[model samples]
Target: MTAVEETQQAEAEDFLVDKAKAVEVEVPDAPEEIGRSDYYTAKEVSMHNKPSDVWVSFLGNVYDLTSVVSSQSRELESDGSSLVFPLIKCAGTDISHWFDETTGDIKKYVDPIKNMMTYYIPQGRFVHVPPAEPVSDWDNSFEVPWWKDATLKVGKLSASTRSLRVKNVLTGHEHLMEVPCEETVGQIRARYLEYNAHAASYTWKALKPNEEKELVFQNLDMTLNLQDNGIADDQPTFEALGISSDFHTPVIHLYYDDDLTVA
Candidate 1:
């Protein structure tokens, strides 16, 4: 090879060596507490697509890979950025297709020419993935691949989604949002904080009729979902009867407690 070509190859090898060293460094422990729902909607996961705040769902679980991706991104040489581009492009998205449902690992297929099984990465390999062929700088000493690391898992991706309408009785304000079906009332309130800063200071309840048919507000159990608190989602029943779901959206009324604790 020419002098210039040899120099370029050496530089690429150096970059890979640096990356291998970085990979050996241990990642920080996952947070002690998430203080959020155990379930997440696809919309919620899509909001954190940036390298500085990336999240992705695979095999029904959500993982926050922001720290790892951001740290590696900062170390990338201009010419070597493409090595991690697949991860950046897939941030805040569901990548369940890339993994095997039974094994919960990246999918593999037989190599056409080599007649051997190999990892199938159509988007190109990213960090922690071993090279297709052995190289001088390649490292596989890490105990676990990022995809198999449980420490990065944050929550489960909700299997189903539902629309909820939360109305503030004191301020006459209302916000409609999509929520995970598996979330509790308390978790839902946490999600509501984005719309109302004082969501926790409000008394959440639902209006229902007594034996006399007079409507009254009943306090909700924060630990339970609407159905468990006596407000079931009847949208499916309504639709089965040929009624539009929009005609009967479940509404949760909130009464402010006049607390100033939360700004």
Candidate 2:
């Protein structure tokens, strides 16, 4: 268990250290008033995937690791300009699972930071990270496994890590995107509304070829649905979403729902 400070450059191998005596630093207490969250969609996080400007998320907290991966900073890189495998590959995305599987613990990322809330300064702009979301489920629901020793976790390519091609039939908008496998149709719809502000102009419907089913946001049965067509969320990723062609991705049709009330 090696204790590498956030200011200290880390080797791919430093992460491999795992002895109970390794990390001896003390993190400060949680803030007196850490306040509420300010969420950022996955699309927003994906925009910062460069060494000059790297950003990554875990569950929902976002962090700017640019200096950690850049040419500066304590020489974290071998040549002093590039980051190691997986970490570099995971820029601009949620690395919750990867960190979990790798060290079999998640604190390696947090422990290095000393204070969990330091990454959220002057929120809603350069960095939109929030204090860890309030727990509504389990106490550790959002946590990476706790380790007695700072074990470097083994990494796994998350199923949600695959960016698929999607098209909005109403606007003829197409994009390559990555969505969490754990997300429900309803969750996806909420995310869609974040950017497509004109959604009400044409009632947008979410669909997947695997189920050939159209999803209506207010329809709890439809929105809460998690599987359909010929695939489930965890396997054959893109295919599970019914997307089989790069030239022709699944289309999310939009049309006015007649039953919707309007003033």
lDDT tens per residue, model 1, 1-263: 99999999999999999999988845444312214678989998999988678899999999998766865564343356645578879999999999999999899999999898889999888777777777776556767888898999999999877788999999999999888888888888888889887687788988887679888988888888777877778778888999987777888999876655433
Worst 10 residues of 2 by lDDT: 121-130
TM-scores for all candidates? 0.72, 0.35
Q: Write the per-residue lDDT of candidate 2 for residues 1-263, one digit (tens) a residue.
A: 34665425455446556443377545444312211123455776788787677667764356666644453233222233322333456777876653445433332333344554333222121111223444343223323222221232222223343234445565577655555554444444555555564444344344433344544332223233344422234436556788653534334455543333320
Pairs that collide in candidate 1 are none
Please, what is the whole-model Cα lDDT of each candidate in the order they appear?
Answer: 0.82, 0.43
What is residue 217's positional error in candidate 1, in angstroms? Answer: 3.3
